[model samples]
Target: MSGWLPVAPCTPRDCAGHRGARRGPLPAAVLLVAGSALTLLGVLCVPAVQLLGAAHRDRLIRRWAYTVVRAFGVRVLVTGERAEHSAGELVVANHISWLDIPLVAAVLPGRMLGKREIRGWPVLGPLASLGGTLFIERERLRALPDAVHAVAQALRSGSRVVVFPEGTTRCGRGPGGRFGPAVFQAAIDAGATVRPVRVSYRSTRRGPVGVDGAPTGPCGGPSADHSGHTGAVAFVGDDPLAASLWRVVTAAGLTAEIRLLPLIPADREPGRRALARAAQNAVASDSAKRPAVSVHQ
Candidate 1:
């Protein structure tokens, strides 16, 4: 791997932990089938969806993405105010699971900036290509500038470009990895606004009771509980796609919360490094009190 390519230390054995609370084999099997069917349906409908006007297309994309997440038995709780839809905005979020892709699209449907490898995934590859994903060669240091230029062109052409600036998936237990500055340069190049979104996973099942007999917040760490189900959603180092998919389908009551922070104007930032830092800080700051959870099916 190139020295510039970002790599996360998390692995399935150490960070993913146990399988946690799972649905019965039958129910899990059903969920897996449904999720796969939905994904294939999306792939089939791409041509028809492209024929619709931009406004209508976006609505369908959002609804389809939301249903896909629901089909996998994951509940979504979106907090924080979402910025009004506009052209040339950069949507950046912390990477954890493959679910993050559709999760973000459900709320903010846009052209995704993904690893070049995703272009070869089974059902998702064609859909990503038809949906206008920008693929970058993450392992080649020489490709960095060209990738940034491609993103800049997309933004300049009035497309909302979604990216995972962390460069790779993390375990989502704590602050995972730093946002790379390279992608931020595209925002600066196009004078686009940067929207930092934070993604966190939690098991809906309550943890162990405290000394006072009330359920305590997350057993031993910031997220996940005794079951370790929430952490299992993470697709980290060396975890096969098939295994991760099975884990997601079997896990019970897995909830993904997306926090949308205020937007930062790229022009106002001194440079890409500073912009990356500001966005990272905004995402890392989870100081706000928990709002009433609104489950999006």
Candidate 2:
């Protein structure tokens, strides 16, 4: 049992199929179903997340969300140093696998901002909404104003709003994966602090990479990398609620790392791309240092 734990970095074969292979070897399909069911249950409970009560309840929702999928046998390893966060911050992260949902949720103690499609998901979406998730539809310029307003309101109202400003996920070592400027404008308008987060997946079950960096299926977002021992990976925009959930269950084996960078706040009345660049640099640098699949994708 102790051997399953990671001591430090080694070759691809070292950690392959050891931890996941253990546990009496359940079928991948079985684990997938189990994980999916737990997630569905969490979704069904979304309403309770909102109705329940205080910040503590919200934290419970996020933690439980992470736990439900974790039952599938995916290990999450959080690395890099976390930056100090001030009140009313807007956290931005490089979107990757669906495992990212919990990775970021684990670190943030505030409301999450997701795409509108999420609100329509079977059970998970509702749970997310009830859990104080802010939903915005893509390419809706008209709605951008409202979305910004909601984010501002959330921040001023004493609730932090975490936004994945790349707008969607993508595959790249770069911090830019197709960013949306409207949200940045919103932050400037609201005078909120922006923090960047980078999410990555390294295998513990398969060899090096889990899958290719190229997206798979109708990936609602970024597809996790798959390198049977090759160390390949895939990053995409955002996945439909279902596919994201499946990534965890079907993963041959892997560890997810979510690194939080220093928060960049809106001080002056107007902030520029420079500020955004600053935040991006912080996130990219720290994220690059963390281990996983290829840094190339």
Candidate 3:
């Protein structure tokens, strides 16, 4: 990591490895122990989900997510109103960082549609699986149909599903990927309402610090302008998880904002593309209002 990582022992004020602590490994060690305990417990409970029931299990998962967020010392900010707890509702949001997952999980506990790669991570993989995340293999075009059906079935069963239609993470300051139309079909088939959410990250520092290890340059990406803001909160292209995690822990006074806009009712007649465009428009409009954070090249 280009930035300094605090390797010190956990203290009353620095247990979460916030910036400017005497560097050492003890703080990370503390978080690792706690995270491992939670992950193991989640994995062990996977088989008992049927007995515990989805709702109860969801509560547990949400609590776990909430704890994980606190362990990182990042603040979650809320804006606008949340959708009613109705069946077949799809929550679509812009993806900016790995933090977005747990942040959303803490707010709206439910099954998430994640990329297949997440299933292979050491601790996070098992925890996410145990939490009932549906993994989609982005490279396997043939499997997409089944994935859509699975999401629709979950919606039909009244399970709220969260999706990052951007397909990949973006720097919080720039335009996120346009929504893919495939996921919207699930809403059409299951008659689910689409909730478009805009997620953004702000740092305690000023100046455009690059997240991708690139130097500040006017040519491209988040470093395009030396806006004197830190991209430490961003988890964009080619950035390793460890580096991102380190950056997050050391970023003092970082906050993530989740704005849940009015829900869009699913069309009675099937129109996946139309629905996708509408949701995309809603998200893009709100996202544009935030300060532009360019993606690091």
Candidate 4:
């Protein structure tokens, strides 16, 4: 394995497939069956996530996430090592698809800070709250101070909090606006370690699962990108959540790439702004030699 790099830039064309024309929804029969199965799984797992203790909760969360990703037919490609988080450590990552939540959770398994809107998202809302997500009303400026304080306290108490500093979803093709410096104060206040991460998605092709429940293809693997790669899972703009869900379920070879950079010691920075700049630069710089792909031997 290689050491983490400060910069990793992605090409704009990498996100082209996501913005392409909508292909409509999947077959109603397939959608109905899949939706029912997923809802049943969610209902069964939410209680375990809530009633269990920390270690058990995190393990269950990881298993739930892994099952859901595979159910959606999404493949993950990770770059860099899984962070060994210290108490009060802050994880900052770029936001792309709603899929980013489970993908990141699958690897990091921490409490997340999400916009208030997610709290009302049907079955997901209740599960998220039970799973320890902290909800914030980002639009209410007056509430910002208190929220930051609460986050800081959580950090100080030895909780791992994941925050998407961009404040809104953006294409993974490139970095969005500067990382909002407001939340960095939490890291500074708690003297927490700050870690930056980058996530990107791409598409490829493979044959459908067969009666034997085995993936079959010419080489029994993803086809070359040049042959066929469809962005069946990009969520941006006003794209409806339902549309993105349909895309992910029906498409083959959808992959999410997550790159975790080196961690920054909070005390080394003079203030939150300086720390924020360093963290942003660490995630924004596309200087990593090449992203390492996870492949089964």
For candidate 4, lDDT tens digit of each residue in 1-297?
111111222222233233222223454336435654764577567765677787787777776665566566667767775667689888998776778887777777788988788888887787678767888877677778887898899899999899888776655543454677778988888889988888766665334421112122221122123434334454655667775676566554566777878889888888888888888888778783245745311
> All predictions: root-mean-square deviation over Cα?
4.5, 10.0, 9.2, 8.8
Positional deviation of residue 182's Cα in model 4 after best superposition, in angstroms? 1.1
Tens-digit lDDT string for candidate 2 (152-266): 8877766677776655454333334434455666677667788777776555543443333343233222332233221222323322444444444545555556665556677
Q: Report the alpha-carbon TM-score of model 3 versus the true structure.
A: 0.76
Q: In model 1, where do residues sit more than 4 Å from their true spots? A: 1-3, 18-20, 206-223, 226-229, 288-294
| Candidate that beats the other on lDDT, 1 or 2, i.e. the better one | 1
Worst 10-residue stretch by lDDT in candidate 4?
1-10
What are the TM-scores, per candidate, against the unseen true structure?
0.90, 0.71, 0.76, 0.78
129 Cα displacement, candidate 1 (Å): 0.6
Task: Tell me the number of clashing residue pairs for each predicted model.
Answer: 0, 27, 12, 6
Q: Which one is best on TM-score?
A: 1
Overlapping backbone residue pairs in candidate 2 total 27
Please provide, for model 1 over 1-297, each residue's C-alpha lDDT reduced to its tens digit, 9 standing for 90 to 100: 543567887767666643345576799889999999999999999999999998999999999999999999899888887557878999999998999999999888999998888899889999999999999888888899999999999999999999999888888866668899988999999989999888887775544321211222222242245543366588888989888888788777788888877789998789999999999988877573247445674
Q: After superposition, how far is residue 106 of candidate 3 from its true place, in Å?
A: 0.7
RMSD of 1: 4.5
Give the poorly placed runs of model 2, Cα more than 4 Å off: 1-26, 51-55, 82-85, 172-175, 205-247, 268-272, 286-297
**Better candidate by lDDT, 1 or 4:** 1
Write candidate 3's Cα lDDT for 1-297 as tens digits: 111111111111111122222213566556545655665766776677647766787677667776776676566666667435778789999876788888777767778998788899887798688777999877777788999999999999999999988676656444456688888999988988888888866655434322333443221234222443345556665667776677666555566766777788888335988888888888878443533232210
Arrange candidates by TM-score, descending. 1, 4, 3, 2
